[model samples]
Target: METSKRLEQALKKLYTAFHNNELNPECCKQCAVGNILDNTDSWKHLSEYHGALKLNYVGKVHQSFGRKFNGYSPLELLQIEAVFLKACGYELPLHHKNKKPKNPTNKDILFSGLSETVRFLCDLDGIPNVMAYTKLFEFEENEKPKYEFSVTD
Candidate 1:
């Protein structure tokens, strides 16, 4: 399926980070948005809190100036991070006291976050969910899957 250039690039980085065990919802430099932005924490300045969607002074200025980091506006970046963190079982605002997964770095945990983030990204670009597996559920003649998918786990 065709994906926007920016979405493709973002997916590539997210895939690499997930496989390399670099994704961490608690770390701004290694979280979903961080990986999309090449591991830079400068995006944190876009908001007052780690998981907030509200843009601060600098962020508003950049938005007014039409600035984009890796093809995402400042607000868009914050929203992406928020979605990822929430899907990863994080309590928004990202406090230590907030409930979170037992193993935040686990592959399963990260996958959930990445999947939701990708969905949100696709929605922003008006495209299908690139990570969807529904195609494997399609039936041919109401008897078998149109596409074959195997699972061993």
Candidate 2:
């Protein structure tokens, strides 16, 4: 499928951020996965009806990554989540986490597997790589404000 211009722009921004090592873990709450699930009607319906646990799992995965690796960018978080979903056998359009599966896997096992998957995806090259599926927008990095204190005698 042809990617939307908006999505392309978002992917570019995400890639740039990843390259610059400027991702912020604090923004994970508002990351691309959360935003897409929250704003898109189709994703919202899927999460509400069939993928609530899966959605929750994604959050756990994010938290896991955050705890393991500090300073993850929002794009990086989304990329990891996307890789996790795909690894768990979810496809696009629906993008719903498998509600019921022939094989039931343990959450801990799944988390470990998906974490590895994210690490692998993050190491890929170029824009059209595996982790760029979501195609979300660029987030401006939060800069720490500088304060100068002067003493007069």
Candidate 3:
């Protein structure tokens, strides 16, 4: 299989395992991130290994938009995506943004762009709101809890 295929497979497998409660990096010390974080050489190796494939995909998208694409590591791109999605109201996992649970509500599920698997998990867990459960602080001091959907529960 091609390198792009491998990276894509790795990404999917990693995310799926993360979602499924397998590949618990928290439990096991031999995590991909941990390995990458342990050594600059390893981090560089992972980046170059994944970078070629990431570039191919980005190149395709850039071509479509007539935009000039430059070198950015896959991890960099992922962080950028995370920031963009957070701005659009999708919460990353707890570790990404130092998340701490806050006021509980029902309408927290209304946000778009989150993966269906994550949304489904939230629903299954009775959390009903990823934003409500993962966020630590909001700028608005008088933010009110919206629980209209709680009645339907």
Q: lDDT per residue, candidate 3, 1-153, as tens digits? A: 122332233334334333333322222121223222221223223222221223345444554565421223444433323332343343443243544224211123212222332343333334544444223221123443222111111
- What pairs collide in candidate 2? 23-73
Q: Which candidate comes out best when scored by TM-score?
A: 1
Q: Residues 1-153, candidate 1: write the lDDT tens digits.
A: 667888878877876677566889999999999999999999999999999989999999999999999999999999999999999998988888988999999766877888888889999999888665434333455434355443322
Off by over 4 Å in 1: 132-153
Clash totals, every prediction:
0, 1, 0
Residue 72 in candidate 2, Cα distance off native in Å: 1.0
Error of 2 at 146 (Å): 48
How far off is residue 55 in model 2, in Å?
A: 17
- Candidate 2 similarity to native, TM-score: 0.27
TM-score of predicted model 3?
Answer: 0.23
Tell me how far the alpha carbon of residue 36 in candidate 3 is from the true structure, in angstroms, after superposition. 10
Question: How well does candidate 3 score on lDDT at residue 146?
Answer: 25
lDDT (CA) per prediction: 0.84, 0.35, 0.31
